[model samples]
Target chain A: MATRAPKTKRGTARRETLLRSAERVIGEKGFAAASIADITRDCGAALGTFYIYFTSKEDVFRELVGMMGSLTRRMMTEAVQDAPNRLEAERLGLRAFLAFVAERPSLYRIVEEARFVDPDAYRAYFTGFASAYATHLEKAVAKGDIRPGDAEVRAWALMGMAKSLGDRFVMAAEKPDLDRVTDEAFAMIRDGLAPGGAA
Target chain B: MATRAPKTKRGTARRETLLRSAERVIGEKGFAAASIADITRDCGAALGTFYIYFTSKEDVFRELVGMMGSLTRRMMTEAVQDAPNRLEAERLGLRAFLAFVAERPSLYRIVEEARFVDPDAYRAYFTGFASAYATHLEKAVAKGDIRPGDAEVRAWALMGMAKSLGDRFVMAAEKPDLDRVTDEAFAMIRDGLAPGGAA
Candidate 1:
């Protein structure tokens, strides 16, 4: 299922261009309706150019899911790099997530579409994210930045919150207030796990 | 697009069969790839019989989403019917949601597919749920069963957590512990909004 990675600089650019085309075409038209020709035409590349880099439409779609995972992780990392603690990181990270959704709504759609188009890729995307996110939470707890709890459950729960908020506030809203939504959602995240929570 | 509700007892049964077939076909192959013939063939009915109930494939798909929405709401209502308080209801509701996902993975897939296949239906599903869910939270806040917070945000956030948990712990799990997952998740939901959370 691995697409042939480009070797030369020009080849690398061609592959990236094709992947971008797939994201737009597949994301908009969906995996079943979107065709390789539509992706190639959008890429400004000949039909045969697609074959040189990827084996099939499914191949390119899988690559797109994988690429989206990497891109989202990089974006989240860069967005929260300077946070003083995990709690603050949670705030910055959520704001970053919502803002990213605003900027790359298609990426969000692509990852979701991967659930049907490529279930393995979809599972890997969230599972991998949850795994790493849980580790981050574990360390935060060890350092007393956050309260002790099951990081695995918290990781998935927090990811779910961000995703739902993005869908409701950003993807679905006409003009969403990113800061306000983040503040409201982060309020729950902070106090939800804060030590000595009242009954 | 609306499917014609059955007028007679036999018509109703036939329509139900078609809807079941549509769920199986569309959930497996997706909306674009799934055809009327595929649904009818799966239903063991002639192709022409499909139009007797559903206007088209799109009609039946829309009906399936509606049906799933009703079914989920019913399940959740039944699950939380006897809860002593909102806190207990939250625990029961989350567990019920995870169990529903496990029982009917196809329903989850169909609803998600609706997001792209029928944007209006997708919006209606979440928007309607969030609207009702917000009301529920508002009542709980008024009763002092939970801390005061933005009902709209909590509704979406809690829904997100349930959805994400269902995906990770039920739909994708090789073997999942419904009780343990529910307890861990309910813990966060409980403490996150608990009054007087420590800074």
Candidate 2:
């Protein structure tokens, strides 16, 4: 049993190391340019070891996409839950998204590139997040806190604004003021989707 | 002069053919993978002929970005002007954007990839369109037709929403009902930004 615990820990460590290597390669070279050789070399792992964990480069990319989606969703959900009201939830969601992009730009790049790598995977990843946000929007709409429409579409639009702004201004630019950008983006969302006329 | 006219016509024809070839090659092979040689070969042009018009592959890409930005902005401006009111202008802008993407999927792909190819070029290209839209939004805000705020930021959010939906759903998916999808997107924007809860 003691031996089994060490083996399992090593496997987990190996998986994480591979993921980090993949993120670095993808971020620098983009999804199309990133090759298995580059990833294996970065990880200082044999090709055989990489294959043992990931079926193929594409498989590794899909796993990366899934991992990023789950991590971002979890973080945003936790942040939203910590908020006191729907408005705060919305603001926190935007901030959490920016923080996620800032913290793991490589992971964020991989997730965005998944659109080109596999549109279905990209859709699946976004659909999960959209559904979660849609549920939140639906509740707010039910409470007459926000205008009613297609909550799913609204959620996507809201998320898209945050994602685009974060990618364009924060990730693409160096030395961006995160606090000001986040505040401006959050204010835009709040005013754009406020319960009634401009608050 | 009459003899020179045919030569000018041929030059224009060759340029158009080269642009079309670049679009196809870049669409299939991506910007980084699509070589000038591939583009020239596809266009049935000599190596020297390629440099006569463009200094480098990057030059062609820059021209393409400029062309697309101008085309999109022109279409959007026309649509907004054709609209009878501010609300209609918003709807028309959404429809115009969807229509442009639907008609030029390859161009859209090229423009999107430009973000990865050259950040400055990408910003310049998008900022052109953003500024144009912001002008329109500023007009509406000045007329007390829409809520007052930073028109530039509002324009970015609107464009971001349209782009995200276009890339995620319309262009990514085959045989998407563009009209319906566009209407759904516009509905959200209309509801979210409509003055005095008019939507």
Candidate 3:
């Protein structure tokens, strides 16, 4: 479904409000339990107002998943843009990822829920990220910034590590200590768990 | 809900049949959409027989999640039992996990569904695995079989890596090459992505 951008500033703000409210309601109550009425009510908007910007609850949920994808890519890119090498970039990228998860835990939950709610969207989100991630690793290899290996495999492995760490350290933690989690995890990422590695 | 084990040999066989059927049906249809009738139908059992073993659909689903946890731990333990070192165990454990996913893709989906269907069970599943895994890593560190690091961080990070790689290379692949995926990922796990490590 094509959810075109609103023309007017007020319409745009209202749409954003609906989207944020949907994120909260759907993320908290889940897609099945969450309703359009709940989403609209969360933002203090009339039930009819939800239809003006989106077609259905699925449409809005898909939009939220899409927003998560773009926001994550943007956040990661900006976080690692100025790193001197791929190794340092990995550190920065991971730290930024944990921070992002802490900041928008609901969005993370929403993206994961997409696996069941919208399988195609869920596949697209990870595949898109993995493809781009693999390409970056390829460039890093060509530049001699990292070891030579299967970029696709490396990308998936690293992504998994980051995702799991985010789940355990940020999402599950009552009081998250991102600094220590990142430090230890990033250390492993940089040097691995094998004996005789860097200090 | 206390679902006592059926005492008779025939009763035990029927319960197994129902659980296996539940795994296939619920895994395919998802927890919300799946019904006890569907599960019993898949196993060619009468509707009344389901209640003999299970209190409700939720009870059976929780049991499946619990089963996955124990089965996974047992499988990993057996897979890595003969490894000479912790690093080797990591490799063996990961390969076994992927193979397990391939063999029982439905069960894999069921455990993942637990994250949404039964949140406490989901936490228990991972937390249980991570705790055991961390202990193993601690032993390895003491023995100098692996580098010294935060065992908990290493455990979760490695688990995440294996999980993500399984999702992409095995779960998502049309014809999975478990050998190559295992090798590539295990290499990164052992030596890491740093430029000047093992060749």
Candidate 4:
């Protein structure tokens, strides 16, 4: 976590700017090469001012990773809220995730980098996501919105599919045909959730 | 590539030792924290002799990533060679991948670290794997063993699923249950490959 949260609206904006700068600097140069001075320089703040918000570079990085985790979950929930069934939610959620990656490439890079820089945060990010996702899968199964299967296994598999698709189509591709990617993935996911699917 | 492939049999053994040593050092300490001297020390090779085989640490690291990519493909192909059909191959492949990860955790770490240390090598590794996987998917579709679909898209999606499962079940879990993970993942893939599937 950050050392402290800003007490005023202006301070909040300043802190936010520093975070945005960290994303750009760290994402581009990577965690090893990125430094607090570089982050402050990019944000047009005095280097000493960084110590006012973040205790260290590691602190800001953990905060960034944590922030991304919350943002991802919230965005996904909002994206699927209008779906009438779990199958539809799967489609909407995959689409939302791909779109989110397109809009925020740094989020993908940061989470990945966290794997090396901050191991605990990295594990927490995915484990937390998989836990919630598994619960959702179990509920869908009980509601008959999907086939009965190993919720934990399916959650991890489904999440893996989305993460890989995002890496390929969104992060790597020049003109990401997200529609096609989602449709193909959704087709496979939808079948796996069908009643006759070997639950 | 290494600085040079040893022509003499004894020299070849020495080079292989250094390469293995590098994997241990890099995998344990990570790319940034790991030094070339530490790698040589592990292999009991003279620090200066390290350069006789590899120009630099980065060169050796890239070679290692490339080696892992080939080894992974070769191992997976061998694992599925006897499958009666595509469905059986999916089961065998996932099982093989998870088992390989459990046995060689370094492979997972190296490929992942390649993302930051050697981005191009990282891209090529997965891209190459996906291309070969897509070809296999296309052949299966043509043989009527699986439903027709976008082979490339499905290849990446399925690869992602296996990769994630490997990370969670094999890399992270204390004692991974490879059999159950394969069974659950295969069930989903089989259903998703059925004729009625969207393909």
Give the number of the best model, judged by TM-score: 3
Cα distance off (Å), candidate 1, residue B51: 2.5
Ten contiguous residues with the weakest lDDT in model 4 chain B: B190-199
In candidate 2 the C-alpha lDDT for residue A99 amounts to: 80
- Each model's lDDT: 0.86, 0.75, 0.92, 0.87
Question: What is the lDDT for B42 in model 4?
Answer: 95
Interface root mean square deviation for model 2, in Å?
4.3
Ranking by lDDT: 3, 4, 1, 2
Taking chain A of candidate 1, what TM-score results?
0.93
Interface RMSD score of each model: 4.5, 4.3, 1.0, 5.5
Error of 4 at A171 (Å): 0.6
lDDT of 1 by residue, A75-187 (tens): 99998899998888889999999998898887789899888778888989999999999999999878877777788988999999999999999988999999988887887
Tens digit of per-residue lDDT, candidate 4, span A74-121:
999999999998888889999999999999898689999999999999
Off by over 4 Å in 3: none
Top-DockQ structure, candidate number = 3
Candidate 1 vs candidate 4: which has greater DockQ? 1
Measured by C-alpha RMSD in angstroms, how accurate is candidate 2? 5.2
Residue pairs of candidate 1 with colliding backbone atoms: A192-B192
Ranking by TM-score: 3, 4, 1, 2
Error at A164, model 4, angstroms: 0.8
